[model samples]
Target: MFNEIEAIIGKAKKNKNYTQRGAVPSEEIADLESQLKIVLPKDYKYFIKHYGYCFWFGGVVSGLVGDNKRYEKLCCAIRKTKYYHDFYDHDSSYLSVPQQGLVIGKWAGGGYYFLFSQESERAGEVGLFLTETYGQEVSKFNSFTDYLSFLVTGTPDPEPVDVDYDRIMDIIED
Candidate 1:
């Protein structure tokens, strides 16, 4: 297990009742991989296996799903918005490799943290893209755990009290 993931699990265990978004079956994961035509990072796979398909701290961090029709996945959100591509496609410096990873964690001001399938030193290694900022390029987050830690430190705001996780996937880019 990734040490960061262990820390994330530990922190969540210490902070709350540990409610999972829900379990994603192995077959669905495999189907997602097949559809994406890329191997998912191992840490992410472990995360899905243990943490399930929902974001942590309510809806702060997004999770990848095996099937979009059945559940919300990172790609599902990305596919809905061409904003990411429209804003960053011409900037080679920004690494517009939407095909290379999943948008697992979103940030304020249209920023997002993506897990790279390529151009990363390790599986589950992530980088941030600030869509609203100029020349922001990428902010490295060593691992998914690190991204979770940032969110944890910022606050443990449980999934928005009024937001329905089931229906929230449609508006991730909004």
Candidate 2:
């Protein structure tokens, strides 16, 4: 998974639209998990740890570092999650805000925000929250990697790459 993500990052790096904000330290990621009160999916954690936040393809993947206050302040997952939670609570007509979910990122100036589920059965999976429908009839992804691939290349599953779980575990364990 890391290798495939690396390839995606490499491709994005060459594009003018890609702008890496910064990489987050492990501590900050942990702090974010604490703030969100959920253990984030492993793949999402890896992205945050190694790449931090970024603006690429057509959206911003936020992190602890808010480089541009005006933009990042609104895009921040923590804030978005909290706000949406309260929002949906007040208005039940709209699809309920994802339960135990975090707003990972968005596309097209917040036209859509990706919600990462922390629920036991759906952990690591992401669902699109189209602002227009309030997330009804939303698209879904198997994992963070798939969601990211869609954001980067307009596909859920990109070119296949061999994955050695042992090696990946070793790298991530450190």
Q: Model 1: runs farther than 4 Å from truth?
A: 2-4, 13-19, 56-59, 65-97, 118-123, 134-136, 154-174
Clashing residue pairs in candidate 1 (N, C-alpha, C atoms within 3 angstroms): 58-159
Tens digit of per-residue lDDT, candidate 1, span 5-98 = 7677667655553445456678766765666566777777777766654443344455544344544534343342234656567865443546
Would you estimate the TM-scores of all the predictions? 0.61, 0.76
TM-score of 2: 0.76
For this target, which candidate reaches the highest lDDT against the unseen true structure? 2
Evaluate all candidate structures by whole-model CA lDDT and list the values in order.
0.56, 0.65
Under the 3 Å rule for N, CA and C atoms, how many clashes does model 1 have? 1
- Model 2 residue 17 CA deviation in Å: 4.0
67-128: candidate 2 lDDT, tens digit per residue: 55654564467776777667656854445666666877654533345446565577887766
